[model samples]
Every structure is written in C-alpha cells, then in structure tokens.
Target: MDIAARSPIGTRLNGLAAALGDGLRTHGHWVRAAQWVVVLVYSVLIVVPAVLPLPDETAHVFTHLTVFSQFVFWGIWWPFVLLSMVLVGRVWCGVLCPEGALSEWVSGKGRNHAIPRWVRWGGWPFVAFVGTTVYGQMVSVYQYPKAVLLVLGGSTVAAMAIGYWYGREKRVWCKYLCPVNGVFNLMSKLAPLHYKVDADAWRASYGPQSALQNTPPCPANGAPNTARTVRIQPVNCAPLVAMRKMEGASDCHMCGRCSGHRDAIALTVRSPNTEVVALGGHLATGWQTLLILVGLLGIAIGAFQWTVNPHFGEAKQWLAEWLIDREVMWPFAENAPWWLLTNYPAQRDVFSWLDGGLLVTYILGMGLVMGVGLALPLAGATRLLGPWHTQRFYHLSQALIPLAGCGIFLGLSALTVNLLKHEGVPVYWVGDMRLLLLVGANLWTLALAQGVCQRYATSRSRRWLAQAALLPALALVNYQWALMFWIW
Candidate 1:
C-alpha cells in the first residue's frame, strides 16, 4: 500500500478517487452522450467556417464565424487540450475527441479485420507528427479556415477510414497513427491521475478455480470431483491496453471501462515524477526521445518562431534579391493553390513558392540544430553515467518532458495572446506569466533529473558528474526560450 493511503487526508483523497472512478463506470452512457454533443460542435466548427467568406479587417471574432472558429480551435481548444494532458492524462482522447469517438463508432459496424503488422509499427507517431507539423506550416494551418479543414478535417476522415479497415471497436488510429499521439503520450507521463491496476488482485482473480459438483475422478488423487465454470465479463478497452500490465498513463485513455474490474483497477493519485524517474528506465524508447528532443523542442519551436524571427525575414529577402538579380521569376509567383500553399488573395495572405520553400527549410533547419544541441548533453550525461547504456540515455531524456511540454504550451498560448490582442484585450500579465511558467518548468525538470540520476549513479560523485553533464542542455533550452520571449 502507498504510505499516503494510511493517513486521514490520504484516505479522503483515495475515497474521492474511487468515487470519481465509480462515477465514470456507472455513467458511461452519459459520457457517450457528451461525446456526441462534442462531435456536433466540432463538426460545426470545422465545416461551417470553411464555407464562409474570409473575415476582413473590420471583422471581429464575435462578428464573424470564421474568426470565431480560428480563436476557438487554435487559441483556446488546442492549447487547453495540451494543458489537460499534463493535468489528467488523455481524458480528451477517451471522452471528448470527435475523431476518436467517430472512428470507434464507424469501426463497430465495419469489417473487424486483424490489425496488419505494418500498421502496428511503433515509429508512426513520430513520423506523422513531423509530417503534419511541417505540412501545417507550409499551408498556414493556424491562420486560414480552409487550411484547418484540410489539415484537421482530413485527419478525421483518415481516422474513420483506418477504423473501417482495422480492428473492431479500437482506436487503432490513435494508438498508432494520430499526429499528436506522440505529443500526448509524452506529456501524459506527467499527469497526476491514472488508472492504477492491482497486479496481485489480478493474479488472484485470474488464477485457476477448483470446484466440485457431480462425480468426476480427480487426476492422481482418485477423488470424485467436478469442474464448475466461473465467468467474469471482459473489459472492452478501445485503446486495447492490457489492463493487468498497464503501469503508466501514456497509452491508457482513461475511459474507465476497466475500473473496478475484479476489484482491482481504480483511478488514483500519484506524483508527477513517478513515471519519469522510476518507470522510464524500463519503458523509455528511442522514438519517444526523438519526439521530445526533435519533434517538440526542435520542430515545434521553429514553427512558432519563424514568423516572428527577424532572421527569417533577412534570409527571405536575401534569397529574393538573389533570385531577382538572376532573373528567376517563378519563385515570386503566388499562383499556388490554397490547398498546397497558403494562397488566399482577398485577405492578402498568400505564400509564394519562395515563402513556402523557405518556411520548410527554416523549420527543418531549426529542428536539426536544436535537436542536435539538446541531444549532445544528454548523450554526454549517458556516457558519464557508464559505458554505453541505451536505456539510461533514454531515461535521462525523459527528464526534459516538463520543459518540452511547457514550451509547446507556451507556443500555442502565444496564438491565444495574439488573438486576444487583436480583440482589444489587455494582456499585460502574459509576459510575467510566461516567465513564471518557464522558471517553474526548468525547476521541475531539474528535480526530475536529480531523481533519475539517483537511480543510475553508483556513487555520489558519479551522480553529480552525470547531473553536471546535463547543465548545458538546460542552458540551451533556456537560451532558446530567452531569445523568443526576452531578446526578440
């Protein structure tokens, strides 16, 4: 039992957790109903805005559905959804995601085929995330309604199609293919709430049961006995997690379908560092590290910073000047379709081929540089810990989740700030808030690094040396953020 489970305050907390878990179990139908409601709203937001004309300079979020959808989708919905993953695991994926719900609903009545081995490939999350991030930048997914429909709506369609082809009643798309699945999985390791499974109870309940009924000879003992069947209803986990083996919140969607099964699983509280510091050495993988170091910290930062960075402007100008002097005119043409590149004429927001090419280059360049910069120190720390241990290297990478998650949140919330600023809202506190979050995230990550070091280091000196090796990576991350928030 957990030490906290013995105290009065802990007892109350446990009771609250149990009640919450039981409520979900009992009111699952209500959750389904709520999911449908969200689906309706999501559909309207995605579809209705695409058909409407683009909002003009005089148009406000309140006055125009297109602008309102932009604010809702980018400014509020996505940023808060990212925040929710760290707070409560993937409840959004389980209960409120229109795509997940729609995909599963379609899958229930569709062909229930065996999942192909290629479909089960583990690297899809990282590949899909990078693909979508780069493509979204190329098309300006955050700015235009058409781009939102293309990127987000297109993802929904693919989800349903994959569901139609894959395992019955399972979130195969989410488990393997969703663009944000890797991000959510990385951030969810820090969630305070998760479905806690009691392994001992699971073993006891699933063990062989002996019963006597009529007259059957027992083997070897020569006793008369009969076998009686005992049945327990199986849990239908849509994400297809093994309830008995689940140790972290990364894969479980928190749907509560298996809660209280055989008096074992329950929603419970835990330290946010528990998974990263303890289980990460065993569970961490190279792909997850790539998603953190490259995808989130590298690609995401570049995507958010390019528009605001003066270097992008200078580079584009230099390229344009060279192109003009060389008499190359095609790159200057804004003839690309809105579906391919951001070409919206009336709003005067169109990306020429030069713009699109440079955007991709800039984002990828940032990703490579930042990814290499961050990886070096982690690699150093890993080497300092001992001779090449791949698991320990990946485990140390887990310590950066707090900073990576915070950086992404801050980037998304920057859109929120820009949208509100356009609405004439005062946001004087945003700067201070950003600083506080950055400091807090850095401190949290440092503490997690220390805890992880404690697990691997054989001596006190070795531990301090390993931690010292990590300081450069922390400094690099802080410098990147400082450039965006302070220097820029």
Candidate 2:
C-alpha cells in the first residue's frame, strides 16, 4: 500500500477508538453496572454492617468518607486517590460520587434559567443538612437516623436551586461551592493528568487572543468569557467553519460536539505540545465526577475504620496478649516491656517528647524542602521556555496541586501506619513495598506536573523549583496533622 493510503487507515483506526470510547461514555450503561456494584457494596458493606450485629464494625469505613479529614489520618490512601484521578480525570463528579450524582439526577441538567421555588425559599435546610451531618460525627451519633431525610430534602431543594442557577450558566455549584469540588480544584496540583489543547489549531480557528475574544458563546449558555481558566487563546482550535466563528471555542469539552473531529486523546505520554486547560466553569470532563466519588468512597471507608471501630480496643488487647503469651527467640524483649516500665520511669515521658519533637521537626523541614524544590524548577522552566507569553505559572500550579496532595498523603500514611503499629492496632502497617509504590507514583505525578508546568512557566529554574517545592509542603502538612495526634 502507498504511504498516503496507510496514513488514512491509521487515522481511521484512531477515530474508531475515540468513537468507541465516546459511545461507551455517552450510553454509560456500564457505568450503571458500576453503580450497581457500588450499591451492592453500600448494602452489604456499609448498611448491613451498620444495622446488623457485626462483631468488629463501628463506622470503620465512614471516616474515610470525609475526604478532607483523611489528610489528617493516613498516607496510603494517597496513591489510590492519584490513580483514580489520572484514570478518569473526575469521573467521580458524574457517576460514582453519590452527592454529585444525586445533584445531577435531581436537577436534570440544571440548564433552565428559572430558579426552583423550593430552593430559593428553603436554603437554610441545606445549611442545616451539612451542619447536622458534621455535628453528628463530632457528637458520635453512631448512625444518622432522621439526618438522612434531612440530607435528601436539602439536596433536592439545593439541587433545584443551584441547578437552576448554574443551568443558566455552567457548573456554577462546582466552580464556586461544593466543598469536595473545591478540594479537587485545589488539590488537583497533585494529579498526574492534565487537559491539553492544540494551540496552533486553536489560533487558526479563532484569531483574537483574549479569553473573551477567542471562544464561541457557550451553547450550554454557561457564563461567557469569565469562565476561561485554562488558556482559551485562539491558538488551540481546529479551523472548522463552525469552530472558527466561535469565541471561547477552546472551552470545548472535547466532547467532540461541534467540529466533526475526534482527535482528543487520553495519552500515556506525560506531556503534549498543547495549551494547558484549567477548571473554567464552562467545561467539565466525565472523569471529574469519578475521581470525587472514588475518593469519597475511600475516605468514607477509612474514616469508619479509623475513628469508630468498636472492637479496636479489644483487638489491641488481643495483640498484646498474643505477643506476651509467646516464649520464643526474643524472651528478653518480652521481659523488657515489664522491666522498662519498672526500672526506667522516664521511658514513657522520653518517648512522648521524642514523638512530638520529631513531628515538629518534619513539619518545618518538609516545608523548606518543598519551597526550595518547586522554586528552583519553576525558575529553570522560565529560563528555558521564555520570550513567549505562553508559559503561564499559575495554570501549571493548579495541575500539580493533586500530585502534591498525593505526596503529602503518602508521607502521612507512613506516619499513620507507624502510629497504629505502636498502638498495637492489627491493621496492615506501612512497609518497604507500600513506601516504594508511593514514591514511584508521586515521582510520575511530579513529572507530569513539570511537563505541564514547562508550557506555562518558561523559566527553567522556576519550573524545577516549583515541581520540587510541592513535596515538602505535602510533607509539612502531613507532619502538622501527625503532631496533632501526638499532642492530644
């Protein structure tokens, strides 16, 4: 076959793959299957354990539900969280997240401009829902009885209201509110994935280069130019007639709705020669919802296990007894536990001081390490990629936030497993294997961030420093949380 003929064949194969992926997403019946699995687990793992007399159950999973709180608890959770974010890019927002899914279902695309009367009138109920749920945890309600109803009602009303409001614009709740979304928006820096726009193609499509001047009016009727967070310059569009006439054309979700094109790809390649996209309200991907959901699920499970397990104390006692009962190679070690207490009165105090001191030291040290790390790289990125106004630092920072969150998460997980083991907890404590996994994952995540960062900040030093800077901040944050436990 001629080379030209082969090129067309390759193009056709690529298009086929893109279409197949889109078909699966558009129909999304498989996602419904996934939902069923979630439902089954919710029933079997979450509800059953709650209602029935399970021996070791005590909301062991519920604590993990609070994604923000997990930052305070364990680091092992970070790698899984990173993996989910990279795979789906926020699928958690659409399908898996119970809250977002419920919001979407209730609001019914939220495009209508008219605000629902119930939401406008009953706003406080939504506030009450959040308050009551958090308060329930603080007060140790064990289970939310009437609180579930409150959640349902408030969600319905809020969905109607926010849905109506955002429907008039685009993803209003996700951009301005939705605490979980906010976390994703902020922590997305730690993510190993980023949205890439073909700048040359976009410029060909729309000539003017302002955020407002470049893209078309949102067909979804979302907010106009203000919604452009990612570089929506005229540089990245395919010059299709319909696309060429549109301003803010880069806000296209690559949903492939406008131009009859299917080139947008989720690549294994860490970086693409393209424009960096940001969380402008006008566009969202299928994966955003997914990441949020999976993370939430993990958080819920971790929380229940960590905070509320009824058998935790008993489990610790059994572990202590078993170790004491044995008389093998380390008999002297066995006797030392008793002797250390009797002979060395200051051992406990000394250990407490050591723990607290180490935690504080890590916090300060990690902070400095991250600050210097990122600054050096970021400065370097600017020096290497400079002269063009294209390398924007702020946008790069956003993409790396999630990865940074992951690094800190791993650091904390290590510390958490350490503390749990010390307390005689029977959980799988951190070891060489898990630590290696964390390091490898975070490094890949950092590379991805740097690739994206280079496009934004031309200074080589700045890029290098910024990329390196993130880890220490994460480490410091983790250390700060660990100190809280030690202090209390």
TM-score computed on alpha carbons, candidate 1: 0.94
Q: What is the lDDT of residue 196 in candidate 2?
A: 32
**lDDT of model 1 at position 366:** 82
| Cα lDDT of model 1 by residue, 446-474, tens digit | 99999999988888898899899998998
Model 1: per-residue Cα lDDT at residue 450: 97
TM-score of every candidate: 0.94, 0.44
- Residue 72 shift from truth in candidate 1, angstroms: 1.1
Error of 1 at 22 (Å): 1.6
lDDT of 1: 0.89
User: Which regions of candidate 2 fall more than 4 Å away from where they truly are?
Assistant: 1-17, 29-82, 109-176, 185-396, 399-402, 407-429, 441-488
